[model samples]
Target: MSVGKRAEPDPYSLPVPGLVRRVRRIAGISQRELARAARISHGVIGRIEKGTSMPTLPVLERILGVAGLGIVVVNDEGRVIRPMLDRADAHDGADRRYPSHLDTILDPEPGEWWGDIYGLARPPETFHRDRSRRDMQRRRSQWEVRVARHRHEPPPPKVPDYY
Candidate 1:
């Protein structure tokens, strides 16, 4: 064996490629069949499995959905984690999510919220979001935090408080 070379890194890592292939395998369908069922081009499915290209979230969801497989967010314990609901009137008049960093003030006193122009009829909530505080942590970092929590380990270094 040649000992002077490092292993080739997987082009797509474990998530997308493995997910696409595994879903099709479990559903007992060929890539062509999956593409037909998902109404996507067969080349796209092949590219995904070959790690030559990455599919957008919607595209992957469509393929998985066609295979009767749905993506679920889960923790280290493998239990399905429900996403945060927008039930507390989290959306504005445009039905867009407000910034998550700032506190959401529910049942606000008039000046407590800036969404008055949206003409909400006594909205159940409002966000006093500060635009400057963009706490947009990457998904990888957030997943690391969840893994730490599941392992009963201390959280990794806190993202600096920008305030």
Candidate 2:
């Protein structure tokens, strides 16, 4: 071995081959057995275990499911990360799933959307660019703090030029 320091595996992640082998060992089943139960070709399990092929998420989940196991996402602190549920009647113009990174607004009011302005069939549930969204958030925070400081103050007098 070279004198360079060996890389250590991340505790949070499992390589596909290792994961497949570990799961099979835990279930005390042979590759053929797992393939039969998971309804995949027998060669698939062998390939996965041998690191020649990687299983898709659904296929992996199916194999694990039949073995009485499940795949769960976890953070560094080992807390479970649950998937967000889609709101009822809250779909974009194309009726597909909303982008997960942005907050989804339901039942948008008139003039609350860009799609209406352009009369596009697939007008968004529009998402703002990251910079625009951040700037808006910053402005909102500043406005909120200003309003909070003068919560009980009366409205300022109108400009003299307007009289």
Candidate 3:
């Protein structure tokens, strides 16, 4: 996507790239200028502006700080305004709130618990069994092919050395 283009429509609010573009326009800064001021690469800024990359809290803060802006999240009633300084806080509580026992069973390190719970926390034993079966099939195929050598195969031709 081109820089300064919004990737999606927002039902209630502007998407990140649109907001970034608006902020940049209000600050009277170009993409290159903003990247330099934010001390980030132009490509990163372009990705952010194109809504392809979601910057981390620190990176977003730095970029927004350059434009005298910060990410603000509002409640449904618009009565509460919360600055989005923590990435974890961005998740919907229903999707993220784990049961106490499950959380204890999968004690993920900070900032590392966002992956699929089944795959990341405790993968099924069948995963290794499937991998071993696939490996055996590949090796059996190679052995079968090697054993089926053509009897009429031609011999290698010799090449003369150049002076």
Candidate 4:
């Protein structure tokens, strides 16, 4: 155990074995060499690459550091956005606020009402609008039924019958 290590480790959201293999190949190092560099057993590296075992965050960081590559945070569209702040930085300092344009480019704000200069609120070629329309249309019949029922229903008696 290291000086400051969590007893229970967090699981990875993304596939890391693939990434380890990719970076290891890019670094042009064998599993054994990578293990040596990261100070972990070669078997551990193999298991990590084979997806049999998961490394702790520190171990993964060490392995990635040795491969001359690091992890990146990405948006929903698979575009790399920014690296996470270090643990120390996470505790202190003002949030790194990006400009509006960068937000538009990297991660657009949700529910942005207006269309852009391109005259499209969203890209026309995307299937999202089509899917949304289909979903709404599918539910439209049910909504229309409710609306019709409300319209046809007689108004409550001017004098309440129960009262």
lDDT against the true structure, per candidate, is: 0.71, 0.68, 0.56, 0.60
Write the candidate numbers in order of decreasing TM-score: 2, 1, 4, 3
Minimum summed lDDT over a 10-residue window in model 4 is located at 98-107
Off by over 4 Å in 3: 1-14, 81-163
Per-residue lDDT of candidate 1, residues 1-163 (tens digit): 1225667856467578888888888889999999998889999999998888998878888988976888787766999999776653677678877675555666777655556656656666765454433233333376575785556655544534332
lDDT of 3 by residue, 11-121 (tens): 334466786677689789998888888888889889888777877778778888887887666655886674424334323335453232121223334333333443554
Question: Deviation in angstroms for 35 in model 2?
Answer: 1.2
lDDT of the structure predicted as candidate 1 = 0.71
**TM-score computed on alpha carbons, candidate 1:** 0.51
lDDT by residue (1-163, candidate 2, tens digit) is: 1235657965335576777777788889888888888999989989887777778889989888875878898877999999988764557656777776665545545554556567655343554334455345545555566997767766443322110
Structural similarity to truth (TM-score) of each candidate? 0.51, 0.54, 0.40, 0.41
TM-score of 3: 0.40
Give stretches of model 2 more than 4 Å off.
1-14, 92-98, 106-163
CA-only RMSD, every prediction: 11.1, 11.3, 21.9, 17.4
Error of model 4, residue 87, in angstroms: 14
Kindly give the stretch of ten consecutive residues in candidate 2 with the minimal lDDT sum: 154-163
RMSD of 2: 11.3
- True lDDT of residue 137, candidate 4: 46
lDDT of 3 at 91: 34
Deviation (Å) of 3 in candidate 1: 43
